[model samples]
Every structure is written in structure tokens, then in C-alpha cells.
Target: MRAAVVGAGPAGMVAADRLASGGAEVVVLEATGAVGGRTRSVLLGPGHRLDTGASWLAGFYSEALAYCSGLAMLRRDVTGTPQLVVGGRRYPAPFEPGVLARSPLLGPTEKLRFARWVAGVLARRRRPHVGPPRRADADRADRIDADTAIREAVGAAAAEYVLRPAFETMVFADLADLSAAFVEGWIRAAFDGRYRVPAEGMDAPWRRLAARLEVRCGVEVTEVRPQGPGGGVVVEPVGTFDAAVVAVPAPVAARIVPPGVPGRPAWLGELRHAPHVLAYAARPHPDPPPASDVHPAGAGRHRVGSVALYPGGDGRVPVGMQGATVSAEGWWSDELLAAGLDDRALAAALWDEGRRLEPGLFGLEEATVLHVARHPHAVPVFGPGHLARLAAWSPCPPVALAGDWTCYPCVEGAVRSGRRAAEVLLTAGR
Candidate 1:
């Protein structure tokens, strides 16, 4: 069997790998000059490289972890307590043990209410899985927005000061725009408390996988259409294959897959995405660095949404220098994109925000901007009804869809979607 995989992102790469392993000849086509898609790493300086995109790997990312099994990994020590900056004051992250009891961010009555709400969620917690939730309770949870659920369960203060910031920092979208099921799944999955990154870069695993496949970079696939009854043909320098997986983003997929394809759902064009702008900078820091990670409560009030400081001697920066990545708030990123600001202007704006927000955090006054990464479709927003839409769609043989949008919006989701797509075609005997 001959298979064609479009896009070289994690989903496409994994799909190609699976098709080849299943005794099919596969060819992977990428639009850009490089692979990895949103998992890209950029060179900052002579000996400095930074992952401008998906940088952290959670313990629950089973598929992504398996892909990076033999590669060198660096575990980020969570022993250092993460800080939540609110109203110019720092408090322990809400997830930390004993934080709810001691944090001044909540009143005595509010703390009790928040604790009860959390206990309820924990009681219903189950192992996180890709795609829509299978259980009845989890499926119900997907019908409500996270913000509404939190506000109704606890109170406005807990939703504002505790949950919203943390969730937004992770997904780059407002809690009001997300589903409660997504939040619950994240809580269960991240409970393991193991976070790591590839020792080389976030893109290392994809690069490793691509090396074993017939990947053609800088090859754009304009269209994927059905050929005859059981096969598909990729246009723009056509190639016919028994099976094909379109693993690009939802919007891109809508454009590439013309009408008449059996599996092309109308909701594909309606999927929402969060925009992101990340500024990478480095500065000399003789003194100890502040918290390695900081999530700003009420991120809209600040220009920068979150900050992640690289550990000392991480090799991403020179000795005695600290590296950091500052992410612009979701709304702010939209403004920047709309204004058509260049990388330099964007970096300058983020630098100014970092200096104003946390003067002592990374010595921003002395920092030099290395690179600015912009993602128009940084993350797929899993809002209410998203899961139901996914569950209702059925795959047609030989023409399958794969992306994080098909599952959850994370590395594991992307990998799992690819595997499922390949399994569909392989099982059909295409």
C-alpha cells in the first residue's frame, strides 16, 4: 500500500511513521522548509538555542514520551514553588499544597468554598485520554464553560484569582472560552507532577521521527481529493495513494480538502484558535533568579501574560546569564497582529511589560531580545460543544483527518490523533 501524509507537524510525522510501520510505503509532505510545526526551536546565538513553541512535556503525554524514549531528557524540578503575581503581590500558586489555607488571595469563607469545589472535581477525576471523554459524567462536563462552572461552584474571587490565570497561562485562551471537561482532564493529567523537555530542544523528537521516514520538506500540498472510489490523489504536482492523512490545522484542512470528501465536516471551519507571541531574551544575572515560572492573575491588565525563566547552567545561555521567554496575553497578541507590528517592535513591547511587571525577576533592564515567535493558531480552543462535534464525526476509509484539533490540544493529543488516523486506513485494508 502507498500512503501520503500532508503537513510535517507532530500529527503528520507520527501518522507517516505509523503507516510505514504498518507495511505501507509513505511519503510526508511539508509546506515549510522545516518540520515540527508549532514545536519549533530557533537559534538565539552562537551556543544558544531556545524553543519558541511547545516547550514542556507533562507526565501524562504518554505518546509523546514514548516517541522521545531514547532521547536525552531534562526534568524541570517543580520543588521550587511557582508564584502567582496579582495586584503587585506574589502568592503561592493555587495548586501548591497548603496554599489555599495560607494564601491571602482568598478570604476564610471563600477558601472553604473553593476547597469544596476542588474536592468535587477531584472526586470525579479520571485518567486523561485523547479525543472526547467516553464516560457519561465527563461528557456532561464538556457542555459547560469553565468560567461559568468555576464561578457557580466556588465564587467570583476563586474563578478570577485562582483558576482563570492558571488555565489561561497553559492554553493561552480565556477560561470563559474553554470547556470544563478540558480543565478537569488537565487537572487529572498534570497531577503526576512530572514535567520535562528534550535536552536538545522541543523539536528533537519530531526531527528524530522524520529522519526515519521519507519526509519531503518545502513541498506544499495544495489539495487532497478523492480519486475513484477507494483511493485519494494529492494535487499540485499530483500523487495518487491508497490512503492519505490530512494532519494540518483545522482551518488549513478546510482549505485543502475540497468538497465531496466523505470525512470533511462543516465544523472544521468553525474551530477557534488562540494567537500567541513569545519573546525570547537573555540577560546577565549575578544574583539568584526569581521564580522560574510566573502566572499573572488578571493577565489582561498586564501586557505580558506569563514568564518562564530558564534554570542556571541550562546551556541555553552563556555562564552568568539567564534566559527567559515572555508570552503576551492572548488579547494583546491579537492587537499586535492586527497592527502588523514587526518582530522588533513586538519584542520591545514585551520587554517593557516584563520590566514594569517584574523588575527583579530577570533583570529585564539589561536583557537583549534574541527572537520573537508568533503563532496565529497557537492552540485549538476546546469550548463547549467541541467534544460533541468531534464525537459525531466518522472517518471514511483512505481519507482520514489528524490533528490536535481532532483530539485535545496538546502534544499527546496530536500524536494520538495521528496514530488513530493511520489505524483507520490500515484496518480498512486500504
Candidate 2:
């Protein structure tokens, strides 16, 4: 059998790899100049690379990571101490066992509420109730969206600390739009395993996967029409195949696939992508406390929110700038200049320690800025009545759907959906 995979993102790559490995002739069509879609690494300098997208990879991604490992895409360590600033005070990362146990992020009552909520979710998982399949042929074991957000399901408190301030920033979306059930599962998974990143860059794993397959990059699949009954998909700009995995972004898939295939939710399309400006600057300040000892950032913290530094051993210093709290208004740059952090002092820090490791962090005589403004609709936002839409949408003939947007907005969800779609197509082909 022949299969055409659209998009060349992680999900599409997974689908293509699976189909090719299964003895099907696979052709991957990607719209972008390069593959990897949203997860591609950005070239910061002449030889320096930074994972501009999908920087974090958790150990919970067993299936995807294992596939990459087989392809020999080495995994890299990205662990570092996370410093949280609250009210101008710095604390260690709060998600840690110790921080969670001692920090004020969760009040006693809120913590008890969280415990009860978690217990309820665990109880449901233990019993394992299955809803009607989204597709007639979908697996009976598939779980549908579970009503589980702190704001909508519980109250304001859970939304205050856990959902709004923390998870929203972490996931790069507002809590109200995300699935509470999904978050619950993610938290559970984290407790069960550790999170890591790929060694070379974020896209290294997918790149390795594509290396073993026939990938046609920069080819946008303009249309996907039925060749005939059981004739498979006719993909424009790439010819036809016996089957096709429409694994691109939901909007892109929606455009290619015939109607009835689930597109992203309107609210998801309405979702706003917050702007993240990562500035690599130099400061003569001493090394801050370790993340293991600091508290999570909250209101009144350093104007720079969500800053985590990872010191690369072997004489290289790399610190990640993740704070997006206040707008371009009153930033630390002004304060630093006002407080008089001499340009020379800061330059010494950047060139001596920072440049040796993250060359991207050096030579900041002027403000070195990299701004990332993702489309609001870029990531799927699991919103009200999301399950209804998922249950209603159908794929165009021979063009099954996958991606994080289908189920949840995470890499694991994207892979699971892609694999599920592949299985569906492969079964039909057989």
C-alpha cells in the first residue's frame, strides 16, 4: 500500500515512519522550507542552535522517545535549577517535592482541595469508564475529554496559584481554555517519571525519523481528494497514495481534508498566543540560589518572571530567559541601566562564562532580543464542549487525522493521536 503524510511535523513524521516501516511506500509533504514543523530548532549563531520551539521533552513520552532512540537521535539533558520570584523574592522551583511541601504557592486548604481532586481523578482512572468512540471504528479503550480544569471545575483558588499563574505560563496558554482532565493526567505522569530534552536540539528526534523515510520538504499539499472508492487520496503537488495521514495543524488539515474532519475549535482559533521575549543579557551579579532551594515566581517578584538558569558544565554557562510577566513596560533593563550595571562588567560575564557555552548569550553591548509570538490559534485550546466537536468530526476518506489539537496540546498527545490515526488507516488498508 502507498501512503502520503502531510505536514512533516512530529505527528506526520510519526505516521510516515510507521507506514513506511509497515512496508507501505510513504511520501511526506511539508509546507515549511524544513521539516519538524513547530518543533524545529532555531539557529541562533553561526554554529549555535537553540530549540526555539518545543524545547521541553518529558520522559512521559515513552513511545515517541523510544522511536527516536531506535533512530539513534541522542537524548540530551536540559535539567537545571528553576528560580521562582515572588514579590521581589526568589524561591526555588515549586513543582519539586520539597517546594510543594513547603511553599506558600498552595495554601493548606488549597492543597487539600488539590489532593481531593487528584484522588477523584485517580479513582476514575482506576475504574476506567469509556465513552462512545469518536469514530465508529475507533478503539473502545480511547478516553474522551475529562472535565478537569481548576477554574471551571473547582474554584478560584485552584485557578489562582496552580492554573492561572503557573500552568498557564508553563503550557503557554490560559487555563480556562486548557483541559483540566489533561492537566491532571500530565501531573500524574510527571510524578511517575522525569522530563528531559533531546541532546542536539528539539527537532533532532524528528529529523532522525525523517532521515529513514522519503520526505519531500517545502511541498505544500494544496488539496486531498478521493481518487475513487477505495482508490485512496489524491494529494495535490505530491501526487496520489493509497492512504494518507493528515497530521498537520488542525487548520491546515481542515483545509486539505474534506468537510466533517474535525478542525480546531473556534475558541482554539480564537486563542491568543502570548508574546515571549527572551533577552540574553549580561550581569555581574553573583550566581543566584539553586532552583532546588528557591520558590516559584508569583506576583511582586522580579519584573523578570519564570527565569530558569541551566549551568552547562565544562566551562559553559547557559541561562534560559522565560519570564513574560509585565509587558514591555518597566523592565529590569531600565532598572539595570538605572542602577548602573556597567556595560563592561556585564560584558565580562557574557563573554567569559556565557559565550563559552550558549554563544547565543554573548556580545550584548546592546540588548540581544529574540521575540517569539505564537499564533493564539497555533496551539489547541481544549475548551467548553470540545468533546462534542471531537466526537462529531470525521476524516476525509483515506485521510485520517492526528496531532495534539485532536486530543490535548502536548507532544505526547500529538504522537498518540498520530499513532492512532496510522493504526486506523493501516487496518483499513489491510
Candidate 3:
């Protein structure tokens, strides 16, 4: 049997690999020149490549760990000892022991209250449903907005000073419009408290997979339609397959697959993805004192949401594994996104704010080279009622859908979705 996997991202790559391993001839189609999708790297200088997207490998990522068995993993403890500058005063903001009691980030009472609320929220989330509650339960937790939930639980002060910065750095969401269940689930993932990056940039693992698979890059898939009266999928002029896995981003997937195609979900068309703008650079010196992933209070300086520097540089850079990457969050990114702002203007503005927060961010001197990456559909937002939409899903066979957006938005979710898509095709026995 022949199988086609559209979009050479984590999801699509996994689908093609699984199908090929199962003795089916498979072809993987990619729209871009490369196969990693958002999990890609960019060059700032000759031999200097940095991961500008999907930066973390993470300890919770079971599929990534299992797949990249021998790949070297690196960890930098930046967030653990973050530096916060408020009105020119630097305060240690570590997510560590006695932070609430000693740190100026939040008052002792407020910190206590917030911590207790978080414990409660996690408890309620993991609490098992009893009998009819499982079937007929109408949990308000799923319906409530994340912004409201955070404000009510942690109070406005703690939410503003602590939670908001983290969320914005991850992805800017109008929490009032975002889902509480989804937000809580994401927060729970962080509770495990582990982060890992590929020794190479984010594309390391995917590049390995692509090399082993039958990958066709730089080919635009205008549409994916089933061959009428032929009983299989004809992925445009790309050839017919016994089955296909549509693993592109939700919005792109909607356009490629024709309306009412079997196994295509209608909700895919209705969804919108999060946009992200990142600026990565190369420097020569150690980042002063505090430098892993730093989230300033954004008190006096608001444009710079959170700043991050990879512990070890990409080895290829002139800095020789000591370079850092910085990002601008909050209004800095959201204001100019999808609005057609020129790259020079955007990078300049982001750096202007970034340099002010941590003068050492640029290393011993100004960044020798800088590269910016813009992702219009970077991450998928699980808004209110989104999960309910997922719960009602039933695949229409021959064609299966898979992506991080299909499950929860995590690397593990993407790998699992792809595996599921492959399993569906394998079970079809076509």
C-alpha cells in the first residue's frame, strides 16, 4: 500500500515514518524549502545557526525523547534564577525555595494565597469524576475564561506580576477569551518542572527523521482531494495513496483539504493559530549573572515581555556556544504582527526594548549578527469550548488528521496525534 503524509512537521514526519516502517511506500510533502515546519533553525552568520522556533525539547516530551534516543540534550537553568529589574532596581526572582517569603515580586500573604489557589486548581483539575458526574457533569471549570480564573484565584496583583508575564512569553492570549481548562492543563505541564533543548537547534531531531524518510521539500500542495470512483486519496498531482495523513496547521489544513472530505473535521476551518515574532542573535561573552530564560517585571519597561538565552551557543557561531537569543513580548510583538511591518523596523524596536532590560543581553558588546523569524500561525490557541469541539470528533477514514492542535498543544500531543493517524491507516488494511 502507498501512503501520503502532507506537511513535513513533527506530526507529518511521524506519520510518514510510521507508515514506512509498517511496509507501506510513503511520500512526505513539504511546502517550505525545509521539513521542520515551526521546528526550524535560521542562520545569523556563516556557520551560525539558531533555533528561532519551537526552542525547547522539554523533559515531559516522551515522544521526542523516545524518538531521538541518542541525540544529545542540553539544559540551561535560566528561569530558575531569573533577574527582574523594576524601576532600575534588580531583584532576584527565582522559582525556588522561600521566594514568596523573601522576594519582592509579591507580598507574603498574597504569595501564600496564590500558591494555595494553584494547589486547589490543580486538585480540582485532577479530581476524578464519580459515576453520573462523568456522564452528565457540567463543569464550570471548563467553561470559565482563564483570565477570570487567574484573577479570582490568585488575585489581580499576583496574576499581573507573575502569571501574565509567563503566559505572554509562551504566547500572547486575551485570557478573557481563552479557556480555563486549557490554561490549567498547560500550567499543570509546567508543574513537572523540566526543560531540555537539542544540542543542535530545534530542527535537530526532525532533520534526522527527514533524512531517513522519503521527504519531498519545496513542493506546494495546493489541494488534497479523494480520487472519485477510484477509492483512494489523490494528493493533487503528487500521486494516489491507499491512505493519507493531513498534519498541517489547522488553518492551512482547512484550505488544502476540500470541504466535506471524509475524515476532515469542519472545526479545522473555524480555528485560528497564534502569531509569534522572535529575534535571535550571537554574542561572545557569558551573559553577566542571570541569563537562562529571564522574564523582567516589565514594570518600568513594558515592551520587553520576557527574554531568553540558550545556555550553550550553537557551536557554529563565533561566540562558540556562549551566544544568546532575545525576544520581545506583550505589545511589542502583538502591535506589528500580521500588519506588514518591515523586518528592520520590527527587529530594531524589539532590540531597543531588550537592550534596556539587560545591558548584558547583547553579551560583551552589541550583537554581531541578528536574525528575526515571524510565525503567523505559530501556536494553536485552545479557547473556550475548543475541547468540547474536540470531544465530538470522529474520523471519516482513508484520510486521518493529526497535529499538536488535534490534542493538547504540546510536543507529546503532536507525536501522539501522528502515531494515531498512522494507526488509523494501518487499521484500515486498504
Candidate 4:
């Protein structure tokens, strides 16, 4: 059987990999010029690359990272000498678990309250060796909104001070719109988890995977339609295939798949996403460059969600260059993003915000490298009834869905969904 995999992101890559391994004629079509989607990495120096998207591989992504000998993944060990800049006063942010007891920033009462809330969540997620099962889905009456759940579980102060920088900025979505279950799982897994980044970068494995497959870059799939019952599927700008995987982002998938396809969701056309703006700038700075993360939430006026510094390191720097990447808190509105992408001023505004976010500890003034990217449909937003809409959504005949939007909002989810789509086609074809 022949299969067409759409959108050459993690999901599409995994789908093509699985299908090809299973003796199917697989073809991957990517709109961009390269393979990795959000795994897009840019050349930092001669032999270095920095992942501007999906930077880390969480330890719990066991199945996804199993191949390529852990995707050159390494367990990163960061020292607990953490400093948090909140306005004029910089406080100690405890990263190590037990070190929290010695934290000078969090009051005893606040720490106790936060601990209790965490304990409650961990307890809920815990599985007894041989007891009744727990439903770990993202939908719970009390977990529809992350901000409300965090505030109710711990306190408003905890949500505002703790959740804002750590979770909100990292996920690129405001806690109010994110599903609490998703956030809880993200935090719980991160704690005590062995996080890894590729020894070189996140794009290596995808590039290798694409090398063994028939991947056509710069080929935008405009439409996918069923020929009829018992007939093949047509992928515009590509040939017909027995089966296909629509692995693009939801918005793009909505546009490509024909309207009124059997089993398509009424709200499939109404999917929502938060845009993303990632900026990387280079400069020459002194020792002890800056804190790893500097969020603009409590800082002075800034439009970005958070900024993470990347100083000159092994292969990360050229001669005397240092760089920083910023993720917008909640990107410009959809209408604004669509209208403002071509606006060079918009990119300038993002770069200026990156400069403001820097602590300026080393008197780094000149930036040698400036790269700004805007993803209008960056992260999926799971709001109220989102699960219902997802459940109602279905692919057209001989076409399957893939991508993070089709499952959870992460690389692991995308990989799992892609493999599942391939399995569905394999089973049906057999």
C-alpha cells in the first residue's frame, strides 16, 4: 500500500518511519524547506545548532527517545544555585526538591501550602501496585483551567508568583486557558525527571530519518480528498495514495481536508491555537552571563512571556558571541499575527523586548546575530469542551490525523499519534 504523510514535523516523520518500516510506499510532504517542524534548528556557529523550538526531551518520553540511542539525549544536571529576578530584589529559587526547606524566598506558610497542593496532585497521579485505576485524561470538572486550579489548590499568590514564570512562560500559553491536568502532568513529570537535549541538537534524528525516506520539501499539500468509497485518496500537488496522514497543524489540516467529509467534526473548522514568537540574538558578554530564565511577568514593561539566555558554550558560540531566545507569553492575537507577520516592525519589537529582558549583568550591548520567527498556530489551546470537539473530529476516509494537535501538545504526543495513524492504516489495509 502507498501512504502520503502530510506536514513533515515530528508526527509526520514518525508516521513515515513506521509506514516505511512496515513495507508501505511512504512519501513525506513538508511545506517548509527542511524536515523537522517545530524541531527547527538554526546554525549557531560552524558546528553548532540551537533548537529554537521543542528544545528538550523529557525523560518520560521513553518510547519516542528509545531510538538513535536516546536521540543523542543526555541527562542534564543543573546546579541548584538558582536565582530569580523579581523586580529589584533577586531571590533564591530552589530547584532541588529538599532544598525548598531552606528557601529564603518562600515563606514557611507559603511553602507549606505549596507542598500540600503538590502532594495532592502527586497522590492523585500515583498508581497503587494493584488497585483500581485512575483516569488520567486532561478533562476533569475542576481542571478545565490551570490558573483557577492552581489558585484554588494552593493560593492566588502561588499561581501568580510560581506558576506564571515556571509553567506559563515555558508552555507559551497563559495558565487561565491551559488545561490544569496538562499543566499538572507537565510539572509532576519534570520534577525528578532526567531531561535531555541532543548532544548536538534536536534536529539530527529527524534529518537522519528523512535521509532514509522519500521526503519532498517545499511541497505544500493544498487539498486531500477521497476518490469515493473503495477508491484511493487524492493529495493535491502530490499524487493519489491508498492512505494518507494529515499531520499538519490543525488550522492547516482544516484547510486541506475537504469540507463535509464523512466523520469530520462540526467544530473542526473552529480549532483554536496560541501563536508563538521566538527570537534569538547574539552578543559579546562577560562571565556569569545571566540567569537561565528571565520572565517579564513581574519585571518592568515587556511584551515577551520569558527569555532564556544561551551564553557561549561548547559549540554554541562563535569566537565572542552569546545568544538568548525568547518565547512570547501569549502571542499577538490571530488577526494581529496574520496581519503583522510581514511587518518588519513586528520582528524589531520582539528583538527589542529580548534586549530589555536581559539583566544586563555583563554590559553586552551589540548583537551580532538576530533571528526572529513567528508561528501563528504554535501551541494548541485546550479550553472548555475542547476534548468533546476533539472526540467529535474525524478524518476523511482513507485519511488519518497526526501531529501534536491530534493528541497532547508535545513531541511525545505527536510521535505516538503518528505511529498510531500508521498502525490504523496498516490494519485496515491488511
Please report, in order, the local distance difference test score of every candidate based on alpha carbons. Answer: 0.79, 0.53, 0.70, 0.68
Please provide, for model 4 over 1-430, each residue's C-alpha lDDT reduced to its tens digit, 9 standing for 90 to 100: 9999998888899989998998999999999899889877788567556776777777667556764464555445444422455664545455455766776656788788888877877776562111111333434732378878877777765665556666666666777887666676666665645667776667667788898999999999999887898788999988899989889888888889877666445666777767777766667656535337665434222356666665665345554556666556565434346566653455556656655655552222365566776677777776545644555453343788777876667777778778878887887788
Q: How accurate is candidate 2 locally (lDDT)?
A: 0.53
- Give the per-residue lDDT digits (tens) of candidate 2, residues 214-265: 8887787888767667666788977878878888766666666665333333
The superposed Cα distance between candidate 3 and the true structure at residue 151, in angstroms, equals 1.1
- Candidate 1 lands at a TM-score of 0.93
lDDT: which is higher, 3 or 4?
A: 3
Residue 379 of model 4 has an lDDT of 73
Error of 3 at 342 (Å): 4.5
Instruction: Give per-residue CA lDDT, model 1, range 1-430, as digits (tens).
Output: 7888998888999999998999989999898898899888877666577887888888778899999999888786564345778877878766654877888888898898887877777777756566776643447878999889888888888887878766686778888998888887786665667888887788889999888899898988888887876545654555788778999888888888886787888788889789889888787666545436777775245557777776447755656678877888778888888878887788878877876666555544577646889888889999988887887775666679999999879888899988988889899874
| TM-score of decoy 3 | 0.87
Candidate number of the best TM-score? 1
TM-score of each: 0.93, 0.69, 0.87, 0.87
- Using lDDT as the measure, what is the rank order of every candidate, best first? 1, 3, 4, 2
Tens-digit per-residue lDDT, 258-376, candidate 3: 88887787778878777778776655555333245556664333666666664443344543445555566534566668567776667776777777776656632365666778877
